[model samples]
Target: MTAQTGSDGPAAPEVSDRIGGRLLAMSLVLVLGTFMASLDSTIVNVGLPVLSVEFGASVTEVQWASTAYLLAVVAAAPTSGWLAERFGARRVWLAAVAVFLVGSLACALAWSTASLAAFRVLQGLGGGLLPPTGQALLARVAGKSRTGRIMSIVGVVPMLAPVLGPLAGGTLLEVADWPWLFLVNLPVGLVAMLLAAWLVPHVPAADRASRFDLRGAMLLSPGLAAVLFGLTDIGSAGRNTPIAVTALVAGAALLAAFLAHALRADRVPLVDPRLFRTPPLGAAVLALFVAAASVFGTMFLLPMYLQSGRGLSAWDAGLMLAPQGAGAVLGSLLVVKPLIDRVAPRTIVVTGFALIIAATVPLTQLAALSDGWLVAALLVRGLGTSMIASPVMTIVYTGVDPEWLPRASSVLSLVNYVGGAIGTAGLAVLLELRLTATGDVAASFSEAFWCVLGLCVLALAGALRLPKTAPSR
Candidate 1:
């Protein structure tokens, strides 16, 4: 396996202490960019009901606003590492921010669902770069020892965004119109763009630059896109059709082709297959995928249970969900650092998954009747989720060498998104099937929760492969 290399080289000079100031500035820019990108993912969700009415579309059709953005991000993510390697990080960062700004404007001006989806694609193309580039910048700025703390802070953005999105969207929708949901990104994106230009340090390419693996990128991007598209289509189709069958078959073929192309390429492939050879790295990736799916899939189902099953309003659901986020912050602050210091990552992960299993078991007992106990169970589940996030991420980063940190982090981040996408879709499929069989939406959802719980158990199995002890700093 080609071990990860630290950002810059082993003996690269440290940024001056003045870098402290620059780091603060750069972090703000990154957080702003992330907030805008993540907000759009869930912000449009609340606006969807209103949008359906405004555009004369069904709720099902309005769902495409989120789906298209996700697919677009998946399609564009692989190219981020290459872009940073070719152009300087600053240039690529600036360009992506600009693209996001333009896309946001287009979304505001969109006259129909079709136009809005197209604009979202543009927004996603830019937003996709943020995760990978953000990690790269963080790794370059903060040395390895500090990486854990940096990532711990970075991790809070994704957790908080979903909670913040509805509040922002509701205010915007109430004060102005649904288009303002998209318009809100404009000023935030522009400020991020300017600050990034000023504060993000530029690392010039080393040794005349690596050749861009265009063919590999072409194969891999479309192949993954096809797979995600197929999965989403299955959820929409509700039954197997020739078109769906063809998409699945084609996606598999394309993915196989992508693997072959990456392996055969003379230059470093778009994705370094060598990273998977390390057992810890591979296991970390798998654990991340499953954990993300379990967590996000539950997030999707729980709110629905509260709203559709219990008849709570959006605001009440948000308020009820607050404890989960609170638990996450608490875990990050109290548990993650000490856990990493004292326990083996495998132990921490196993414990975390066990906690998740414990938390989820209570969910199976939920009924159509409102119960304070159900809300309390969800609060515990959120705590378990918080315990899992940072430690698992720390494990993934520790396995990688410093130089490859950016790429490894990027891949790991992408897998989390991919997992969430698949998990949510798969649970939706299962819920629908069970609903048909059982004639109870709540019961169907409960069965789906059990499936998610089973996946968490599987994740614990993967966590077993982590090193018995933390890697030396």
Candidate 2:
């Protein structure tokens, strides 16, 4: 099932066609953590206004609930690989689930907006750790042969979370209270933690991890957080404020330093700079980043467009977005994995971006589109997204040695997180400027779609650089 970049075909026998047995059981357990973490990222936005009124705070002040969690998630992501290597992926994942559970309950019991936001930080740390660590564990279990199918299982969670979050939040609010948003995580988290403890096997801690790239950590960690904070500031504060500018500059400098140090470091750095030069890995990282921006940025822009251009209620807009979830499911079931074993991942990724580009072109004519047309475009885009995420991620996991998978997952996850933030923030800023200049909402969205389309096109370029076939381990 291993495909060598140097070979004309796979170096091993065909991979299994489906997930089953204990691997399936363990995958479902990991999915619980992934679902909760990804779900909370979007779901809480639905409760922001309710929280503002409950605490008698300004909407902007209550907005910290989401912002704090986001920054916490970004900040905590870099530490996950280190933790997994030190304590084992299964242990780190279990600890993350427990921490997330406790944080969720604390969030439910929060007495003020400040408390809620603070509790969300604790929650976000766990949320940040869960996905990558769990992915490492599962990828180790599935190995090169079954990596694509594993991705189809796990990658689908985040895709569906955005579509489902608002609905879940709205339903809980209608039937219960704002606390239910956080409370919903309790049962799921508990079940996941317990099941994983009983069923998931431990990955041994690395002896090389003893070196612990303290220098790289110092530089890259804050560098990443600062960049994301700056981007978030621009989105929330609107335009390039002094804080955003300062953070961006400082973050860039720190990141540059980290890369410099990593390249020359005596020991294995936190993330090996060489990974970027490694085939399939570097290309996979770029592809995921662009895909994240296009998918998540559009996720941000569409809600506003739907509310303004189509004059749909938030609830209605959420429903319109539901097509993405359906398309994701359809693509996974009918297309992505089926061809993955039979076709080169390079072909899947290229075709995925092509679909994404074609899907995005419709949005450029925002003013002229009808509800049905928009839905179809989003559905196709979701399918394209599925096509990209599974193959691209599988390429990363399967191509690398299992010993290196933790850091690769960490690097790719960090890139994806920052890319999503950039997309959301960049679009927000561009849309604002466009609206101010044109005074036409439709025209502003059209301009923004052009940007999304441009990013997708750039991603496609990177996709083409990926090995025309998967490489052997």
Best-matching candidate per lDDT: 2
Off by over 4 Å in 2: 1-18, 237-240, 470-473
**How large an RMSD does model 1 have?**
4.2
Error of 1 at 76 (Å): 0.6
Model 1 Cα lDDT, one tens digit per residue, 198-277: 66666544445568888877777777777776677666533455655686688788778878888777887778877777
Model 2 root-mean-square deviation: 5.4
In terms of TM-score, the best-performing candidate is 2
Residue 379 displacement (Å), model 2:
1.0
Candidate 2, position 373, lDDT: 95
Clashes of each: 5, 3
TM-score of candidate 1 versus the correct structure, residues matched by position: 0.89
Q: After superposition, how far is residue 281 of candidate 1 from its true place, in Å?
A: 0.5
